[model samples]
Each structure stands twice: as C-alpha cells, then as structure tokens.
Target: MPLWLMILLGTIFGGLIFFAIFMFVRSRKKSKEALGASAGETSKYAGQAPPEPEVLAGQVAAIREHDAAFDEGRFLKWAEETFFKVQESWTERQASGARALMTDACFADHERRIGELLAKNEKNELDALAVSGTAIMGIESDKQTDTITVRFNAQCADYTVNAETGEVVRGNKAVGAWVEDWVFMRARPDYLAGGGEMPAGGLETNWRLARIDEVMG
Candidate 1:
C-alpha cells in the first residue's frame, strides 16, 4: 500500500477508538450522577418523620351524644338494643357480627339464663326507674381512654300477686344498684335479633347511642 493510504487508514482507526472512549466516559458519569441522586432521596426519606393518624371530628360528637343519653336516663334503651342484641345473636348461633359482649366466663354456660328468668316474670309488670330518681348515684368519665363509670343507688320494684291462696306478693321498692361498661364497636341490632352470621367485621362509630324505655309496667 502507498504511504498516503496507510496514513489515512490510521487516522480513521484512531478517530473511531477516540469516539468509543468518549461515549464510554460520558455514560459512566451519567450513571454515577443518577446513583448519587437516588441515594440522596432515600437518605432524606429515612431521616424524616412520618405523619400522624388523624382522628375524626365525628367521633368527638358521638362521644358527647353518648354522655347526654346516659344523663337523660336512656341507658335501658341502649342496653336493650346493644346488649340484648348481642345476647340474642349469640343465642341464635350467628355470633360473628356482634362482639362477645360478656366475658367467656361471665355467661358461657348460662346463655339464656337471663332470658329464662325474665320470661318467668312476664306476667309481673316491671317499671324501669330513672337513674336520677332511683339508684344511679354519680358518673365519672375517663378522659384518656374515653370511658364512663356510672355509680348507681339501686331502686327496684317488685310485682303483686293475688291473695286467693294466701299469696299477697306486693311491689317491693328496694334501691339496688348495678354498673355496666360499654365500648363503641360494630353492633348489628338486626343481625342480633334475627339476621344470621354477621359480616366478618363490624363498624366502630367511636360513640355509643343510649335509649331507655319501660316494658312490663
């Protein structure tokens, strides 16, 4: 080959090598910059604090309503709907929806024991008295946990019986007291009354509604 041709070929080969090296260096710098940016982002997130969970405003309102209901002597209604509803569901064998209101040991064996007693006393008229007029002495609220403990001064009345067989059972007006604790959880009154297996989970409304009413008397 001629010297000119050799020189021209050599120049072309050198230019190709230089171009490859330049591209490789540029790519490596770009990769390193991207890695550094990613690291900075990750470190920032790791060092930063997380946001707190927000409590609903409606929960506060519900809490107030619960207190008002109790003060107004509507607890019997609440118990009939909430407590009795749970008991009813458990007896009906659809216990999934209603949270086990009573402890396992409290009424495990005597599921329908209360109901049986009440049924026997069906003929006797029962008058539910107000907490203020009867035995409810005082109530105190726990701010931290949002719980209320109502102290009672139990006042109960007895039924009357005929004197045909020397059975004169007069109404007994005795002040007896009982206390119950309530929490807000998914409660299905319909499910407890008749609806079968409650859905897997119940709603937690953050507040309980209380209702009171007289039955027999």
Candidate 2:
C-alpha cells in the first residue's frame, strides 16, 4: 500500500474511535444526572407528612361513647326515610303525617310553607325521589339535647302545578340533583344510666328533625 493512503486510513479510524468515546461518556453522565434527580424527588416526597385520618375517626368514637344505643346505620336509614316522607307530605299539602317526625318549630315552618302554597293555588310535585348518598357530617350535644347533622345527596323530578287549572306552572320534569343538610335532635335523657331506646315501631318517639338547609355547590 502507498504510505499516504495508509496514513489517511489511520487518521479516519482514530477520529471514529474518539467520537464513539465522547458519545458514550456524554450519555453516561446524562443517565447519572437523571437517576439522581429521580432519587431526590422520591426522597422529598417520602419526607413530607401526610394528613391524619384519625381526626374524623376519633370524633365518631366520641359520639358513640356519648350514646350507647345510638346506632349510626339505623339512624341513617331513618333519616333517609323521613326525608322522602316529609317531601311527599309537603307536596300533598299535609303536615300531619310528618309532624311526629319533626320538632315543633320545624313542623310550624312546614305548615306555613304549605299554607302559602295552598293560598297561591300551587302544589310542588316530586317523582322518582332517590337518595344517592348520605353521611353524618357532624354531631353535637349539650345538657339537654343531642343533634346529629347529616348530608344527603339526592335526585328527583321536581315541578310545580297549578291546582285550579291542573297545568304545569314552574320547574321542569327533568331529573335534578339536590344536596341537603338535615339536623336530627334527640332529648339527652339518662343515656349513661341506661335510657336510650328507639320506640319499637319507629324513631318518632325518640328522634325529631330539628331543621333542614339546602347545600349549595
């Protein structure tokens, strides 16, 4: 082979080897940096504290201790049933059926509202009422009364009709979602001295709905 040709071939091979080495080193450095960043991120997340779940659990435990016979499941079922029944009674313009399930003030308010509707010759009608979800949001008690507030998410077909003409006056027939907070109250008797028992037939003898407020948003 000619010396010039041999020298040219050697230079080309050396340059190729150097380029490969440079690329390999650059990639290795980048991999290390990426791995380090991932590790740092993991460590940072691990070091942060998470919110405690015990707060709500502790509150529930305290409420349980306050009333031994207070069954959460039973109360929730009763609340849901009462909610639907009250709505039905309201639409029917009769508070007598639900009066036993509510406080005096609450019943009076309901009666006044029904009276207004009657005077206006209008009636609110609800169909396909269903409780989608229910939860006890709060519990409080004093020397005389114990109140348990519950959140109810429900959907129904709500509309108003003119009583005289039997025609739709307001609201749509489409199903609409609504949220409400209902407060049920019971007299604080000698619960610690063995006193809390819901009447055999129903909660009408023990629990009375204090008030109801709609939840927005």
lDDT top scorer: 2
| lDDT values, one for every candidate | 0.33, 0.65
| Residue lDDT tens for model 2, 116-175 | 778999887776878889877766775556777777778766667799887866655666
Question: What does candidate 1's lDDT look like per residue over 1-217, in tens digits?
Answer: 9999999999999999999877654543332221100011111112223222232224334455534333324543453354445434433334333434432322332334334333544222223533332222122333222322222222233333332342424433332232222323333333334544543332222323121111111
List the RMSD of every prediction in angstroms: 31.8, 22.4
**Whole-model alpha-carbon lDDT for candidate 2:** 0.65
| Regions of candidate 1 where Cα sits further than 4 Å from its true position | 1-71, 100-138, 149-217
TM-score of 2: 0.66
- Highest TM-score model number: 2
In model 2, the Cα lDDT at residue 94 comes to 82
Each prediction's TM-score versus the true structure: 0.24, 0.66
